[model samples]
Target: NYCTPYLGYPYYSSHDEMIHNLYHNDDCMPMRGFYRWHIQDPICFDEDLKVTIQQIGVGYRGLFERQDDVASVAYWYQAEPHNRFPKLPDKEERWPR
Candidate 1:
């Protein structure tokens, strides 16, 4: 025979209270659960040019999913120009077409 309380444990604790107080006082962006493991070499950007592939519409969603896949990232990077944003140069100018 086993006995368990339906109420379970207390909802609020000292640590939780402290954390909530501190959070309310500070202006900080709460951490998100979205994360990706790096599987390829980091993409190097030119400081002078400062050109980046900014995705428009629903394109950003695919970027996070392909963060670990080198081939996919490359493909996306190359396809950036042709996307709805079309920030990058023409397809013929870039590699991995």
Candidate 2:
């Protein structure tokens, strides 16, 4: 979602202006915003296969020449074997809008 960092309609414009996504310190990292859903069971990606397994990551949105630092966390609960991750897109394709 880093390409469209803002979470909703009201906050969309704020991202382009850096109104809410700013760095207070050079060494510190900002917390990734997330949503909560109250339900009887864990979240599922597909209706046919109700499970909690999902993939998540983070990114930074900026101009073509602006190369900023980004950090993220990855947690695993299931013991399923994994496949290789895809190669990252080129710089031009990664430009944030």
Candidate 3:
């Protein structure tokens, strides 16, 4: 489960440096790195039972490179302004797979 601060949003450190260091020790082979963001909401059952439900989205990255290449790539998540939680279209909705 993901954790958010008591009063503010959470922040994650970029793993680019870690990946770069690993590549250097492994003879500089190309590598791909990935991470994901999850929205956690508390679910209440009766009066005392509770659990966290998680909604996972697309994978994101703070860094990506071809090892031998010089260019860098980064990515992150940005919530849509109008609809903080987007609703699935009726035709695309499903109960279970």
Q: Give the candidates in order of TM-score, highest first.
A: 2, 3, 1
Query: What TM-score would each prediction reach against the true structure?
Result: 0.16, 0.24, 0.21
What does candidate 2's lDDT look like per residue over 3-25, in tens digits? 23323222222123334435633
Candidate achieving higher lDDT, 2 or 3 = 2
Please give the range of 10 consecutive residues that has the lowest summed lDDT in model 3: 65-74
Superposed model 2: Cα runs more than 4 Å off = 1-41, 46-79
Model 2 clash pairs are: none
- Name every residue pair that clashes in candidate 3: none
Candidate 1 has its poorest 10 consecutive residues by lDDT at 67-76
Residue-level lDDT tens digits of model 3 in 22-94:
6455554434333333335433243353333343434375444322322223333544674465677687465
Ranking according to lDDT, highest score first = 2, 3, 1
Candidate 1 vs. true structure, TM-score: 0.16
Candidate that scores best on lDDT: 2
Residue 94 lDDT, candidate 1, scale 0-100: 86
Compared with the true structure, all predictions reach lDDT values of 0.38, 0.41, 0.41
Q: Write the per-residue lDDT of candidate 1 for residues 1-97, one digit (tens) a residue.
A: 2223421222322243335666564454332222232336544554332334443333645533222212222322343445375488877888754
